[model samples]
Target: MTATSRSLSFALKSATVRSSSGHFLRELLANEHLPQDELQARQDHAARAIAEQAMQESPFYRRLYGERGIDPRILDDPRRWAELPILDRATVKAHSGEFATPEAVGRGVRTALTGGSTGEPLRTLHDARVPSLALAWRMYSWWGIQPYDDLARIGRWSFGRMDAVKNTIAWWPTRQLSLDAAVISEETMTEFHRAVTRVRPRLLEGYVGALLELADFLERRGLRIPGPTAVATTAAPLTAPVRARLEDAFEAPVHDEYRGSEFGWMAGECDRQDGLHIFSDVRRIEVVDADGRPAPPGEEGDLVITDLRNRVFPMLRYRNGDRGILRERSCPCGRSLPLMEPPQGRTIDVLHLPSGASLAHRLTALFSAHPESVRLFQIHQQADASLTIRVVPGPGERSRRHVEDAVEDLRTRIRHEVPVRIEYVESLPYTGGKTKYILSDLPAVVPQAPTPPPDTPSVRA
Candidate 1:
């Protein structure tokens, strides 16, 4: 091999070995076979260590806790965690640099940007080791993807020119791995089919919408690529219909990964598909009701996450715009991580009715009820119970009554007495960055009521 080729080969081999070893350790740590009490004890220890580190390192936490009149010493008791105020996307954006530890940032850390579904893009920095650990955590929990076997990643890299080098370097630890961004396009589905057949990847990972489109294309062309051992879908919402199609097309179990740019990999789906298992070791997650109190087990609430591992830019009690119910039940697979059944779509999909009560998670159900007629759709609710339903009909007779019935069903579910307007168009618009199928156009409006303040603790940095 040439000098460059030799270097690439060596890098690939080294990455594979490192990944395999990391995964082995993570699996041991996360194994459900361990006694529940033992796991809880371990988690408690890790949480304390992380909280202490944040109090010492992060300026944002130092100020936040000081203002809230909290003592960092109280971190020893996990029960006092709720005293820390929750952080949201808005707060993070407003105070990005303050969250960073000066020492960590000085060490040549990397940065990641989030094009959140709410139309706000925020950038945050992390230590260099974070991505590798994030990947290891994902491999151990989701697909069992080891270091060197060939694999394919199908999403667009947010970075432009850097992507070519990043993609090349990402495959260095594993031999025979190929990264393909072309899979995002419907027209490139044929190309993807040919490439996958050639590479015969061990794992397939990418946006759920792109994968679903490719699957539809394959189904139409009567073609089947070599089946991968595991498939991981992320980046976009995975509706029931889309997920079902992916499983059928790949002829393999599909794993859904719940992650954000801020928090690398928060939760993962196992073979059982009961619910996504939250990564309790890496991050602390809380499901809080509308009143900001802890939601009971199996009750839907906002997903609040604290990235204990990300001390360079701490994400304490960050409000992820997704909602889900925390299930107290243990998984049959024997993993000890907490379980969460994420609400199907983004928070935007939930409409607010005229009666001041917000609608629930029945939008997906409404669409699934008439799957054959609707191809793609998006719904947005305005302030006065006025709603807009945008639909992109598939190739068939456009049934006005069926479309009207679907809207009526959604209206009935959302509000007993409210009006809705349905608009059918040739194609729905894409968000300038990613092709997110669901969106909420509601303006960010914080309530005027002086709510119970977040738990405040003082940190000395």
Candidate 2:
């Protein structure tokens, strides 16, 4: 066989083996018939297995455990697992090499970059086993999507060339229905609608902004794509207003997923939609107070995650830069995983007004107001309350009139009279470190421009 064919075969076999093993583990943990204590026992066993793997293979963890003077065997207790120090994007980026397993890095495994929402991009590496476990866990718990299911697909709306190679390859195994969200033209939107109608995949997934754009198009034109079994939104936070609009248009139960490039799947919305279910099996999640100690349940703190699945590249106690509260009450859905309140906007998202009051969630409504002409845009708030809006027009003029109209719409929605300067840049700047689209920026709070992550590089408009 050709080298390409051999590589494909090896990847498929590895995915299959990992999937099988992961399914067996998931089934053991997700046994609804078992008592609560029994399920907890199984969960503890799984956590220990993952912890042991990390302790053995990961260089970062080996150093960490050595420094802490704690044996990996002592991680048998779930409570002790929480005591491990939390990590953040800065730490991961600063010490990327130390985190990876020597063998995996030497063999040239797949590397991915995260477009951090806060403009801090993180470069991450993963073996096929990492994504394999993620896919298996997702299938077993969330949608039960099998490898053979044609309907198991991914919908991506991104604007980076680095992703093109990986995305193209991934599409071969699982059908990928792609929509070029970078430039949302009339033709692109029409093509997107057509593709969605044709695919009719069981699961629909994409960024919150892109999905909402499609939903708005469908709603405005009185058009509807064939309904999928489930609609999953990620990459961007899903506000209640956007979620309501997407659910109404798609006619499917909407679920939110919280993940990072450094770490695979950290938390996701359960069927109940009450709160995000933390995947304690593959990772340890901590809600820490300002003092860096573990916050009590029902208290708000920064989210730090330690990814146990990625031994090749460990993400120990990685801070996600998201603030959320951990709810103490058990979810009605009956999953043993802990619940976290839907994360509010990121720290960089806060708009500090001249009056001293901070504004969040206001910009979402402003952007969503003009769905047809304006496809994607970013807002930067100056210290004096003057705002700079970078916009990508749908199919219309980027003239002063268009700017004024958008600004008027924003004023009406926000009920604040702030001077609006519209800059029709080619594209909004991405945080240099990551590929995520930043919706709002306060110049005062964030003095320096954020850099996009290396993998998912950004362009300046």
Give the TM-score of each candidate. Answer: 0.67, 0.64
TM-score of 2: 0.64
Q: For residues 296-403, what per-residue lDDT tens digits would candidate 1 score against the true structure?
A: 998878878877666667677787766778888888777777788854445323344445344432343344433446555666665665777777664557555667
* Model 1: CA > 4 A from native: 1-33, 106-108, 131-144, 157-187, 347-461
Per-residue alpha-carbon lDDT of candidate 2 for residues 67-147, written as tens digits (9 for 90 to 100): 988676776666776666677665665666777776575544777654355433356777655444434345335554343
Against the reference, the lDDT scores of all candidates come to: 0.62, 0.60
RMSD of each: 15.9, 14.0
lDDT, residue 306, candidate 1: 78
Model 1 scores a C-alpha lDDT of: 0.62
